[model samples]
Target: MIPYTLPEVLRLVWSLVWQQIVQHAQVVAWSLFRRHHQAVAQVYHYKRRLALNTS
Candidate 1:
């Protein structure tokens, strides 16, 4: 196995940190998207039910 130099070690650490940050951001974004979609769906469902009840 090749022994890592200081720069190489730093680079590897930076890469891992960046990957983890990107993954976390993606998870947060998806969670928010799902919540927004669910909220919109619920609103639509309620509106439809209200219209049917009034008709």
Candidate 2:
């Protein structure tokens, strides 16, 4: 069996954690991008209605 030292194990875990963080950030970014475009389309269809609905 291959033996892994402590720092090696820690580095591996850290890499996995960073990957998850990056993936979550990508999902949040895509969601915000979609919402921004949706708001833009709403403005084209209903300018004042969108503002009124938000307020």
Candidate 3:
């Protein structure tokens, strides 16, 4: 077994943790963006329907 120094072990652990954090952040951001766009689209459709009904 190769013995890693303390700093090396810490660096490895930190890199793994950072990767997970970045991935989670990306997933969260994408979901929020999709939700916002869906909300906007729904509002647009509702407005269009209202205008059609009023016309």
Q: Which stretches of candidate 2 lie above 4 Å from their native place?
A: 1-22, 47-55
Score each candidate by Cα lDDT.
0.92, 0.87, 0.92
Model 2 lDDT tens row, 1-55: 7899999999998888765555888999999999999999988879778878999
For model 3, residues 1-55, the per-residue Cα lDDT tens digits are: 8899999989998888765555888999999999999999999999999999999
Q: Write the per-residue lDDT of candidate 1 for residues 1-55, one digit (tens) a residue.
A: 9988999989998888765555888999999999999999999999999999999
**Candidate 3 whole-model C-alpha lDDT, 0 to 1:** 0.92
Model 1 residue 43 CA deviation (Å) reads 0.5
Query: Distance from true position, residue 2, model 3, in Å?
Result: 26
Give the local distance difference test score of model 1.
Answer: 0.92
